[model samples]
Target: MRTATPPPPPAALTVPEVMTALRLSRSKVYDLLRTNQLKSFTAGCARRIPTEALRQYIDNQMGEAA
Candidate 1:
């Protein structure tokens, strides 16, 4: 018998990753950040979005659609 390995912890996403996940352009992603629709923070000079924040943004969009 063998023990199963635990999954790695979720990490913050970069701007490009967020853009790819949302299927939006670079400008649009920055726009969302600028408008406070998506929440993010800067680590030094790099911008990073928390996984929870991304999920929350998606949930908000679905709620608005419904």
Candidate 2:
């Protein structure tokens, strides 16, 4: 029997990934970061968004809609 492959570890998302995920423009994603609506960190010159932060943002939006 073949063993199943383990899933890859979660990784921080780049700005482009966030844009694709949210279907928002690059400026909009940066706007969210600027306004503190989304949390992120910079490593050197690269900005990355944690998966949990994105999830929380989504949850907050859902809550607001209800």
Candidate 3:
């Protein structure tokens, strides 16, 4: 009998987590948030970035490179 595997977690990523994943500095990440380039929302004192937004940002950058 084979059981089904559970799905992965949601796309919520913290500031430091996103910074590490994007290889960007904390200031740069914050600047993105401030400039509305990166989508994010507040969770009390913490902020979270969706994985989709990161993907979109990457796609936009790639498009601009061409």
The local distance difference test score of model 1 is: 0.95
Looking at model 2, the pairs that clash are: none
Residues 31-53, model 1: lDDT tens digits: 99999999999999999999989
Which ten-residue region of model 2 has the weakest summed lDDT? 7-16
TM-score-based ranking:
2, 1, 3
Which portions of model 1 show Cα errors greater than 4 Å? 1-6
Comparing 1 with 3 on TM-score, the higher-scoring candidate is 1
Candidate 3, run of 10 with poorest lDDT: 9-18
**What is the Cα-based TM-score of model 2?**
0.89
Q: Candidate 3 regions off by >4 Å?
A: 1-9
For model 3, residues 1-66, the per-residue Cα lDDT tens digits are 999999896678899988998899999999999999999998998999998888888898899999
Give the clashing residue pairs of candidate 1, or none: none
Q: What TM-score quantifies how close candidate 3 is to the native fold?
A: 0.84
Q: Give lDDT per model, in order.
A: 0.95, 0.96, 0.91
- Sorting all predicted structures by lDDT, with the top scorer first, yields 2, 1, 3
lDDT of 3: 0.91
